[model samples]
Target: MDDADRIQAASKFLLQSPPGEINDVLNDVRNIISDDDSLQAGVLPALREYNLAQFITADVPGHQHQSIVSDAARVPSGSSDEDDEQSQDRYWDPRSRTSFRFDHLTLETSDPEHVEPDSESEPFRVALENAALAYLASHYHDGVVSVFSTPGSASRFTIQIVANKYNPNNFWSGRWRSEYVVDTGAKQVTGRILLNVHYYEQGNVQLSSTHSLALALPPAIAPGGGAAAATKVLALVEAEEGRYQASLNDTYAEMGEKTFKGLRRALPMTRSKLDWDKVLGYKLGAELTNSKAGFSAA
Candidate 1:
């Protein structure tokens, strides 16, 4: 097809395409018009459209879709045993692995019975939610946070951070969902953080932990004190959030370094490592030759 026709044809697919498939279309276009700078320029709009498509396809309503094409494209190559070992090691790195998320924050009253805050506390509750949203917007990078509160029940709120990835060909899968439920009364915030990590691939490992956290809110913000109150609330919650985020980050590192290792050994427990050359020579072992698990077999 001519350049205009090709660009037109490509835009149709690109606009409707999901995040995974966008790169495919772009690659095809580049291959077809490698030397044509002007043609590439014409295609920029379609590429921009792909950016918008991600936000449209995000799993959570308010979240921005994070494209994993670049990460997934980093498939390990070369036939050396050392390269294979290095690749395996890289797989366990938490950042590269497709896992874990800060799901949401559930709010509760300070009462012993753990009921929702009183409706009269609307001003304070809103102040809290606004502070949280601001904190998340600035601090969290991978996902977006949103607030969900019922009309009459102004005291109860569910502030959530949603992020997800879906690629059938990816080796790593599953989710580590973490949520915090805290009491909104008083500056000394106390709450429980719940974690549930369930991995579908790489030995189907699962890990979980629940713990309580407390932080003293920053000074200067008083309950129902309007804008000034909101600013102080932001700092207060930000401190608590920093702590909560630190806990989750530490847990992820532990999962990669210790928890996952204990569950699945990359190498057998023997003193000497198995000879990969011999194993790859066998028919079944031939499949291992392909860095990816199912790709070579298929």
Candidate 2:
């Protein structure tokens, strides 16, 4: 089409009429983009539809437009949050004996966890739970720990983990769940466990506390490249186990079937070190720990 015809076409769909000069069209183009190229290829596409709609609905025609973003700008500006999000979905898959899968990582407020609870003073407690779960899933690297979070009420949130359930090793067994109450105004979070798992075979074990504890978000660790991330999976798991065993006085969970009351009464805490060889048997192709009460070969 001729320059005159081009101008006419642009004028009609603008949802209003504008001048019919090529220079007029040039001005419209300038309005849509900044004078400089601040955006790269990936970000430009998402902006396309939003930009077109915005241009057509301009309050004043032919005004120089600056880049505009809709609600989805949660990540770094111009970096597709979706790209980061999509990649994380492929995290450790439970079905995969080889690696772990952490799912549905999001920074956007549109996510359910980010939703404002009915009360302004205390929004849904899950608001920060996501951050905790994401940290666990992203940094822990071990597919053994399943990290999940849920919003129960305006002020209630739950973050839980079931570790070493699938792996064929005794490094970690059973589950640990933590619940949090969020007070948006005071910026406080506290939690306790509602359901605890024990290996009746090994004796009832208390992995986490039933009493309320302050919400503690683990500090951010280096998010390395693929290989490094993979390496961390086991390292984090081992470190956690070391902390667990050390906390328990370098003993393993009691073995053999027993009552919950029996477990609490005086069941012996097995005086054993975390046989690194047995606990990490899966990763090392080492010997598995014999099925002892709650701890079993995955």
Candidate 3:
């Protein structure tokens, strides 16, 4: 088969095959590409195309991600640069809708919020994007609970949750409080629930402390979805805590076969519904931390 056909076969195998049987899939592709030099010729181009195809148009609520489907279509199957057919340096980030021209040393990306990758917006949003939000939100939550942190990491990860003042059901909260009862019936809960874990030098060792988030339960939660959503959410958060206290100790992100360890064991001995809070309230230049937490909540 030609390069396109061969690469297509390999990609299909990798995606469709059973999860643990990748070595076998590689072996099958190895035999095909090894025999056909032309097929090999198409590998990099096809791989790039596939890489671009891997992303779908995403429209995240509080944020956005890059996509490449449209640009990939522009390049066509088994093709190169418009100006120079031989140049393989052409690439685009679909999320950013940005094109890169290494040969010309140019970089361009449209605002994800502004441009449409396709004539019509794709129906479904990307799962990974939401997964990332959930992951980061959980991470933000964890960052607050942990005492010892990677140096300089505290500020870098603290992100602001967006506030839509216009929406009657989803407005923003004014004050940041440590008490879990810091809810004000917001139209929407759109901020980080910061648990500003304050570490103070109590002589030979430093004492770690805690903090808060302004939470607002959604309308759904107040009505019927509370229990089901709560179960799912609290589980997610507890999972995150266990992960932070365990694997997060060193920073190699992992999942499955969960375990828990020191500090995490005792700290909030209760399982409050994780869904009770929407996210990390990241305000632009807003301080959520309180005084005596050793850092100025300025």
Candidate 4:
């Protein structure tokens, strides 16, 4: 097909093609165009249309228009001096903003020891649980994690974590434990920590909880060339994983030290004659002993 015909075909494909069909059209046009400049020019309009479709279908309404205007302003122009000035002014114009709010973490544990019958233990346990939740949320925000979750009444969030295969074994291996301290007497404790996945969604405000863990992974990574698009996807994915790892790590650390210390401190004077050095020494020794065993086996 001639350049004009090819452009028209591409435009039509962009307008009516199902997502699965776009790749076929792209491939066909790519094969037909011989010149580098013509091929790039031919694909530009179609790409813009695809981006517009994505923006419109995004969570925020009218995002497509905002994206288009932002993109137009950034296109460096070698036209007249007046045009360059106009482009600069347009780039600075305020566009519609999309707001996001992250909710507190929802705890789900599998440890029966952490579940308590005493009313006094409830608040402390809840506080520890919520603290873990908040830590995870903050981590997600910082890591630029991507998360996808179901949207119906029963939907839950699932976050993805990517790790390099070459990283140290310690990078991927760690036990997470979260516990609530009750009275120092009887050595009683209640709480559970299960090795489970986490999911997060943007713009979701519901505070309810669910029992199931369902996760759907995105089929491809590095799918877009646009800087903004790439950043958003990476951020979402990293944030989700960061939240999970932080929650798990923080909980485990708190349970080992603060929770144990609080319980020890709450004991009766006679029993409170605790040996801090012995307690910490024994804990650290146990961890080292375990690590040695694993290393030896390896």
Candidate 5:
């Protein structure tokens, strides 16, 4: 069958088969596809191209979990020619460097204040914080909780939970309280959440970060955060790609130099040590003799 026919047949088989039976059918189909030279060369590339385009153009959300803070240092203007030249090249100069820091970023739904409270317990408020934390955890790959106070701090982060923020039936509003703490030892700034509540009724709930790093919490609970994790991932991906490209270039250059040296050495009698044909024949005979002796020993 043609490549398209084969693919269609495979797909149909998969659809009809039970999940447990899929592996056997898939194996058979793969064998069939690999046997076809035309399918291997043409159809596979076409399928991959289509898949990649779909992946790249997928309409994912715009928000990210982490963002890199770009810090630009102002270069002082100098009067002398040498100083002016240095000033102009500040960014590129080995001594001059720009520092980039990553912050845990988050995004939340805009506050909705008009919905009436269903009860003093504020079920919607609780639910919203949980949902937001879950979303943040899944998207950003970070452990988050609906915290009322900073883990070790006496101060609480304020959350404004308005009623009917997400749904008409729901009544809760949330605001985030964020704090920046500088760790002198690690030389990093930690953005901590003080308290996250729906703000329907202001009472403090104790919160901690003792859960797994992938904990799902409410976005309202982890207020003032969105996109920080995703931004960090993107930055890492970019840095890794750059490193890989440099290593690849270096490897290619090394390979090329080795190949050139080998070619140079392969040329006819530039050095008078030995003749190539005679040397190769002697080596082959010695290898054959050794092989026969080894076999005889076995």
Candidate 6:
């Protein structure tokens, strides 16, 4: 078929259909594209093109993570500018999406006999990290969580939960994080969890929402307490984490769905839908012809 016919056919196939009929339309489009070598070569790539980096640029809510350690010290260091660029490029690739953050979380305890106040020997950092991980894992089983240790003599660290979704017409990315700093002398832990969701789609649309909670809790274990005391603290932390997780999930779900509908509602309009293949084909052919004419004049 000629360029005009090709554009018309493609436009008809590309018309946005009702959500329930989307899968059937997609199968038909694929079959059509496969039958026409020119359509497969010229139009399929344009429809599939999505620049995730341009859309996933929003930072997580209420926090910025700056690590002093080099890539060699941290497993899969993603803090540097170069690393972020690489991640952005590979956002759609499944291999780059895997995370093993829970492996770094381990319970730490002080030597019961020599439990001196504010002693450097206590493993408060690891214990705190473990507590945060436990909370996240129970709630967001499919999420990718990462743990980062802060530099200097401060007894603190951060844990982040990252999740993303990519499809034919939608892109979504979210990050929720908590930073826990422990006081050995006081046997207390203080920090906050921040949750945010951001999504973008084909119609030049964007939506986002954020929620945060401040936390102050007893340490996972008392300085001099042995395994018995540690068990009690762990149970308490679990219950507390459950409460916070529920609150964050409820708020995020409500906001995310509201914005999701706001953008999708813009897609289909009017009483009758135009045949996108025909519409896009006419436009594409006209543009192509104009471009050739301009180039010849130049």
In terms of TM-score, which candidate is strongest? 1
For candidate 4, lDDT tens digit of each residue in 250-281? 87798788876776656666765567769989
Alpha-carbon shift of residue 236 in model 3 (angstroms): 17
Q: What are the clash counts of all predictions, listed in order?
A: 0, 15, 20, 19, 35, 7
* Candidate 3 lDDT tens digits, 50-165: 32322212222223442222232232225444544333443333334343332211123322233333422111112222333464465444211100111122111111221111
Q: Model 5 off-target regions past 4 Å?
A: 1-224, 263-298
Q: Against the true structure, what is each candidate's TM-score?
A: 0.40, 0.25, 0.23, 0.22, 0.21, 0.36
Quick one: best lDDT, which candidate?
1
- True-structure RMSD for candidate 1: 20.6
**Candidate 6 at residue 129, lDDT?**
38
**What tens-digit string does per-residue lDDT give for candidate 6 at 120-198?**
4234434543554565567664444433444444444344444344343455445444334443345555544544444
lDDT for predicted candidate 3 compared with the true structure: 0.32
Residue 193, model 5: lDDT of 33
Off by over 4 Å in 6: 1-122, 126-137, 143-169, 204-212, 223-241, 248-298
Order of models, best TM-score first: 1, 6, 2, 3, 4, 5
User: Which residue pairs collide in model 6, if any?
Assistant: 7-281, 10-277, 11-276, 11-277, 11-278, 12-277, 12-278
Which stretch of 10 consecutive residues in model 6 shows the poorest summed lDDT?
102-111
Q: At residue 257, what lDDT does model 1 achieve?
A: 94
Clashes of 3: 20
Q: Which stretches of candidate 4 lie above 4 Å from their native place?
A: 20-24, 56-298
Runs of candidate 1 exceeding 4 Å displacement? 1-120, 141-185, 247-271, 274-298
Give the clash count for model 6: 7
